[model samples]
Target: MDRIAILKLNGFLLVTIQVEMHDQLVLRLQDDLTQMLERTRASGVLIDISGLDIVDSFIGRSLAQIAAIARVMNAATVLVGMKPAVAITMVELGMSLAGVRTAVNVDKGMVLLHEAAGLEAR
Candidate 1:
């Protein structure tokens, strides 16, 4: 099975979604992230979706689910690097992406995570 490249940095998991995700791939990612979170005991998840031009409903739901599951595991999820058009489209599509925090970019997301976790940003 193909796996998404998830990087661990300063106790946070960084997931940069660079490709169009199908349902199976998204499911696999959710599973992999959950397991990784448990193993690493990470405090936060920062998902960078800048490469994705559009987030269809499936992907949006997957992101929401990932955030919710991460929260249940005591980890916060912050979505970042969304394109302006993508954000507009998501809203037009009526996907609120509830329960998920967001940042304008990866850098901002990192800062937000650090602040939320009470960790000093480097």
Candidate 2:
């Protein structure tokens, strides 16, 4: 997998992962995210999943875990660009992403992250 793109915008770190949606990639992404959160002291995070075709349990779990860790690190995490089919399947599978915020697009996700972090758009 290629190195994920991390962009900082309006107090949020936007991460665009360029890999197949799989367990291993998700775990690696999670580790990188955790380190990024800790090192950057970012106020929020937005994960753009627009390139992903499917989201498996492991990937979902990794996202949730990342959100949890981000909160502890004083950052909010939002998942963006979830495909409709994948969202439906996740809902049907009863997969709970309790603490993670989600949005239909990167723009919306950034807005959510900013709102959660009390950051005014610049």
TM-score for all predictions?
Answer: 0.95, 0.90
Clash statistics: count for each candidate: 0, 0
Q: Candidate 1 lDDT (Cα, whole model)?
A: 0.91
Best by TM-score: 1
Per-residue lDDT tens digits for candidate 1, residues 3-121, read 78988998999998888788898999999999999999999999999888978999998999999999999888999999999999999999987778899988899988998789997
Clashes of 1: 0
What is the C-alpha local distance difference test score of each model? 0.91, 0.80
Which parts of model 1 are misplaced by more than 4 Å?
A: none
lDDT tens readout by residue for model 2, 1-122: 64676776655688886567666667777788788777788999898887877787777778888889989898988898888987987888778887888998877887888789887654
Question: What clash pairs does model 1 have?
Answer: none
Model 1 vs. true fold: TM: 0.95
C-alpha lDDT (0 to 100) for residue 71 of candidate 2:
91
RMSD of 1: 1.0
Query: Highest lDDT, which number?
Result: 1
